[model samples]
Target: MAKIAINGLGRIGRSILRLLTTTEAGEGFEIVALNDIARPELCAYLLKHDSVFGLFPKAVSHDDSGLTIDGTRYPLTDNPDLSQIDLSGVDLVLECTGKSNSREFATRGLRAGASRVLISGPCPTADQTVVLGANDEMLGDQQVISCASCTTNALAPLARAIDTAFGLVSAHMTTIHCYTGSQPTVDAPRGDLVRSRAAALSMVPTTTSAGRLTDLVLPDLAGRIFATSVRVPTASVSAIDMSFQAQSAVSEKQINKMLAALPAPIFGTTTEPLVSSDLRGRPESIVMALPETHVTKSATMARVFGWYDNEWGFSNRMIDLARRMTSM
Candidate 1:
C-alpha cells in the first residue's frame, strides 16, 4: 500500500481523514503522517466529532505523541513550514493548507521527498488542475496536481456535458454556498467588506473562481464562462444554478439523458426531487437536479442545477486522486 501524509486539518483535511480512517475508500493507501498548526489533541478531538458529518463511526484518540485511529497511530507534526516536517517513507502528501496552492510552496513537498503533492484547492502553479469526470485523464506524470475547488468540481461535468451535446457559447453560474470557516459568526472587522457581517444571519454575495477555473479546465470554453457566489446560513450542502447559451437546440429531456448517462463516481442522477439538505453526505462530485433542469425557447438557452456536499464529495475525489497519484 502507498503511504500518504496530510497537511492542514481544516474542514477538507478533517473530512479526508474521517473517510480514510472510517471507510474502505482509503484502501491501497496508508496515512503515515499529518501536519497542521493545531495541537494533536485538538486535531484528534475534531476528527472524532464534526458538526456537519457528526461523530465518526470509528474510535479516535490522541495524545502529545500522535493521533490513533483504526488501530494505527500516525505521527503528527505541528508546524507550517514543510521543510521541518519529517516525511520519510511518505509517497504522497495531501497539501490541505490553502496557503500552498502556489507552485513554489507546492514544490516544497516534492523537494521534501514526496513523490507527488496533491493540493486540495485551485492551484495556478499545479502541473494540472484535475476535475475527475472532465479531465483527470490528463494527470500524466504530473508531480503536483490540484483537485480544484468544490465549485469547480460541481461545474465541470455540466460544462463537459453541455459542450458534448449542445455547443456552449457563454455560461454563468450563481452558487448558493454555505458559510465557511473564514466567515465571522457575528459582525466583525475584516479585510473583505461583505464577509465582516454575521455569517449565519445574511446571504452575503461574493466573488468566485469557478467560472474562470472552468475555462482553465475546458480551454474550448475559455472566455465564455462567468460565476459568482452567495454565502447563506446553511451549514453544509451547496447548490449551483447554471444558465448558459448554447449554439444548438436542446431540451430538458436531453439534459436529463446526458446527466443520467454520466459515468459513476463522477456524476449521479436521481428522478426524485432533492433539497440541499438531502445531499449533505453524498459522495459523488456532482448530483444532477433532474426535476429542475430546463431549456429556454429555441433551445438556445439552457439552465441546469446541481447539488454537492462541498466537503465530503470533494474529499471523496481527493482520496481517489491521491490513490491515483500513488500509482504514478
Candidate 2:
C-alpha cells in the first residue's frame, strides 16, 4: 500500500485525513502519520468522525506519542519542521499547513525520501505553482507540486474554456467563499492584518491571489485577470462568481456549449439552479455553468458559478495527483 504523511491538522489538514480514512478514492493509500500543534482533542475529533473507518477500534494501539490504525502505528514526532520528519518509506507528503509557502519545505520533503510533496496553499517558489487540470502535465517524477487555492481551481477551467473558444479579453471575479476554521467565530485579535476583523458577523473584502496564479497556470492569459474574495458565514462549500469579456463575440448557447463540452469529472453544467449547500459533500470540485445569464452584448459578459468543498474537494484532488505520481 502507498504510505502518506500529512502535516498540519487544522481545517484542511483534518479534512484530508478524514477523506483518506473514509473515502473509496483513498483505498490504495494508507495514512502512516499525522502532525499538528493543536490539542489532542483535535486529533480525537478527527478519528471519531471518519465516514468509513468510524472511531478507532479498541484493538487499535495508542501511546503517548501517536495512535495506530489498521496495524500501522505512526509515532508522533514533536518537531513541526518538515525537514525533521522521517519520510523514508513515504510515497507522498501532503503539506496542508496554512503557513506561508516555502521552497525549503518542499525541498526538505524531497530530501527526506518523499517522491513528491503536494502543498495545500500557494508556494513561494514560482516554479512550484500548478493547477490540477489546467497544468497537471507540469507534475512529473522528482517534482514538488502546489495546488492553487479553491478559487483558482474553480475559475481556471472556465477561463481556459472561454479563452480557448472565444478568446479571453479580460476577466473579473468575486468569490463568495465560506468561512474557514482558521477564522474566529467571535471577534478576536487579528492574527493576519487582513483577517483580524470579525468573520462571523460581516462580509470582509479581501485580496485574492487566484488571478496571479491563473496567469502562471495559463501563461497566455497573463496580466488579463483580477479577483477579490468575500468571507461569508458558512462552514464549507465556497462559490465563485466569474465575469468574462470574451475577445470574440459568442452567444449564450455557444458559451454554454463550450462549458458543457468539458469532461464531467472536470466541469459540470446544469439547467437546475445550483447552490452551495447542494455542493456540500460533493467529491469533485465541480464547475456549475450558469447558462441563462450569458449575455451577448459588445463585451460578452457571462456569470459562471462553481462550487468547491475547499478542504475536502482540494485535498481529494491532491491525493489523486499524488497517487498518479507514484503510479499506485
Candidate 3:
C-alpha cells in the first residue's frame, strides 16, 4: 500500500479522504497523516459533520495525537508550514490548499520528504496538469501535479468530446457555480468588489480559470476558448452554459446523440429536467442536459448545458490522480 498524507481539511481535502477511506479506490493507499492549520477538534468535527455531504459514513474522532476514521488512527497536526513537517514515509501528499499555485507551497511537501505532490486545483508551476479524460495520457513521472480545478475537470472532457466530434473553432463558457468558502455568508470584505458581497444573497459575476486551463489540456483550442462564472446561492452543484463554434454543423438531436454516447464516470447524458440540487453527489465529470441542447438554424453554432457536483466530481478526479501517482 502506498503511504499518503493530506495537507488540508477544507471541503476538497475532507472530500478526498472521505472517498479514499470509504471506497475501493483507496484499496492500496494508507493515510499516513493529515495537516491543517485548524485545530484538531474543529477538524474532527468538520469531518464528522460536513455541511454539504452530511456526516461521514464511518466513525470519525480526533485527539491530540491525530484523527481516527473507521477505527484507524492517523497522525494529524496543525502545521502552517509543510517544510517543518517530517513526511519521510509519505509516498504522496494531496495538497488541497487552494493556494498551491505558488510553486513554493506546491513543493513544500517535497521539501518535507514526500515522494510526490498532487494539488487539488490549478497550478501553472506544477510539473504537469492532468484533467482525467481530457489529458490524463500526459501523466507520467511528474512529481508536482495540479489536477486542475473542479470547473476544469467538468469542462475539459465535454470540450474535448465536442472538439473530437464537431471540430471546435472557438468557444465561450459560462458557469453558474455554487458559492464556496472563499465567499462569506454575509456581505464582507474579500479580494475584490464583486466577491466581497454576500455569496448566498445574489448572483456574483466572477472569473474562471478553465478558460485558460482548458487550453492547457486541449492545446488545439488554445486562445480559442474563454470562460466566465457567476456564483449563485446554492450550497452544492453547478451548471455549465457553453456555446461553441464548430467547424462541422450539427443539429440539436445530433449534438445530444453525440454526447449521449460519451462514456461514464467521466461524462454522462440525461434528459431529465433536473435542478442543481439533484446533481449533489454525482461523480461524473459532467452530466449533459440533453433537453437543453440548442442548435442554431445554421447548425454551425450551438449551445449546450450540463450539471456537475463541483466538490464530489473534482474530489473523485483527485483520487484518480492520487492513485496513479502512488502507483496504486
Worst 10 residues of 3 by lDDT: 319-328
What's the best-to-worst order under TM-score?
Answer: 3, 1, 2
Per-residue accuracy of model 2 over 1-328 as CA lDDT, tens digit each? 8888887776667667666665677788877777776555546556655542245433344466785656556555546676777788888878778774667765676677777777887886725666666777776654677788777877776678778788888888888888766677777776666576667787777777788888888898888888889888776778777778876667777777777788745566667776777777666656574544567466466666667767667777777676776783
User: What ordering of candidates by lDDT runs from best to worst?
Assistant: 3, 1, 2
lDDT of 2: 0.71
Residue by residue across 1-328, what tens digits does model 1's lDDT show? 9999988899999999888888898888888888889998889888888888898887888878689896789888887788677676779999998887567898877777788899999888998999887887788888888888998998987788888878888888899999998899999987889989999999999988898888888887888888999999999999889999988888899878878888878888777877888899999988888998888876889898888899999999999888788887
The TM-score of candidate 2 is 0.88
lDDT of 2 at 309: 69
Candidate 3: tens digits of C-alpha lDDT, residues 227-257: 9999999999998999999998789888988
TM-score of 3: 0.97
Per-model TM against the reference: 0.97, 0.88, 0.97
Task: Report the alpha-carbon TM-score of model 1 versus the true structure.
Answer: 0.97
TM-score preference between candidates 1 and 2, better one: 1
Off by over 4 Å in 2: 39-41, 47-62, 68-75, 191-194, 289-292
- Which pairs of residues collide in candidate 2? 190-196
Q: Which residue pairs collide in model 1, if any?
A: none
State residue 216's C-alpha deviation in candidate 3, in Å.
1.8
lDDT of 1: 0.87
